[model samples]
Target: MKISIFAGVLLISAALIFLGPDTADATSFDTRHVNMGMKADQCTAVMNEGIRRLNQANTFCKSTNTFLTGDNAYHTGTICRSGERGKVWPQNHNLRISLDIYPLVECNLKNKGAKYPDCDYTGVAYTNRTIIVSCTSDKGGGVPFHIEGNLVKYK
Candidate 1:
């Protein structure tokens, strides 16, 4: 009986150590809710649309005579990644990765119009960039759940 209990405990411990924690919570970091094997053009369109929405949020705040903090801005745009959005890629992480999102968009809010308050109006320009993301397989295939980093230059 003692040996059986000890063996069960050891097995559980090993499983925890090797598998890490349950990744259900990680789904919150899925800013784009993208899946693995997505084509580059599709990813770019998604990213650009996200940026457009973010910019629209900023514009709305300005029009309403309100100023949103960085966090609020992200939230308003439905792009909130609670904790794992901008972390550097971990070498030992267990999640599958997809680098298919190449030449992505890097958006910035630029203030425009002299008499339209500080940031009431904004504009965006599309540019080619690279992004690194981590994915998790929950439904069936892998879905991207984190934006590991945005690469400026890559080989």
Candidate 2:
């Protein structure tokens, strides 16, 4: 009886170890994408703003992998593909700002589907400094480029 009880306990422990929640995994939750009706000129402004905020605050925030907490960040990049188009627009020097924000908004491989929502027309979120904006190509179906960042006063 004693040996059987010990074996049962060991089995249960092993099961929990293997099947319990794995916090180490990088995963994004509650992903949603919204259309912003933005243009290339606006996207440039957002990129510049994000970099400025980061530099001024000397800190950063990112879209957390947690579900529905509403803390948000933006990822910026240029999407150029042939055959199938998403959004098309002229490229300029400001587009390079995406590289600056890359570190702040990288998604975790485990949290693979993480995405931020579009900013309101006023471009304010939680505070005036944090904004979510997308630049859609004047051409139809060109994937929209995004820039999101925030400046907040911690109370």
Candidate 3:
């Protein structure tokens, strides 16, 4: 009986460990794709950051849909294949940054290059969470690209 109970406990613990964090994050969630919170200038800067980050890694990437829970971070994804087309990839958690105090009207970008709408997008969550996603072709410099919005919830 003791051994059985210990084994069952271990199984349950393992399940819980895997399920718990996902559930918590899923429950604490919000998302959207075509948000219009950030202005032209703000969007431009966010795109620049995405480009710089991707250049170093030279890989496709996405921003976390969740915004403004902390200093936040973004993640880099693979080369984004045809299969991952039109998917919202959570590159980071909150990547969760939030001004959380004001209307977030200024785009809050401090030191970024000039604004250009060549290719790229930026948006703000209702809670002032910001996300940027964009890309370009290596040769043509005119390859059409689209950003995927990953919206997932824990079960």
- Compute the lDDT for candidate 1: 0.37
TM-score of model number 3: 0.25
**Cα deviation of 35, candidate 3, in Å:** 15
lDDT: worst 10-residue window of model 2: 22-31
Candidate 2 per-residue lDDT over residues 48-120, each given as its tens digit? 3443544633333233211111223223223222223212223632221211211122122222232222221
For model 3 the local lDDT of residue 120 reads 44
Tens digit of per-residue lDDT, candidate 3, span 1-155: 99999999999999997665434433322221222444434554555465574463343333332232222221222122222321222473212211112122222233333332233445444333233223232221211122223222322
Q: How many clashes (backbone atoms < 3 Å, residues ≥3 apart in a chain or on different chains) does model 2 have?
A: 11
| Per-candidate local distance difference test | 0.37, 0.30, 0.34
Candidate 1 differs from the real structure by a C-alpha RMSD in angstroms, to one decimal, of 13.1
Stretches of model 1 off by over 4 angstroms after superposition: 22-26, 31-98, 102-130, 133-145, 148-155
Error of 1 at 17 (Å): 2.2
| Residue 127 in candidate 3, Cα distance off native in Å | 20
The model with the greater TM-score, 2 or 3, is 3
lDDT string, candidate 1, 1-155, tens digits: 99999999999999877655324434445344323333333433443355476564333222111111121222211112223332224572433333222323232234433222233223222223234445453322333455554444444
Against the hidden reference, what TM-scores do the models get? 0.29, 0.21, 0.25
Q: Which 10-residue window in model 1 sums to the lowest lDDT?
A: 63-72
Q: What is candidate 3's local distance difference test score?
A: 0.34
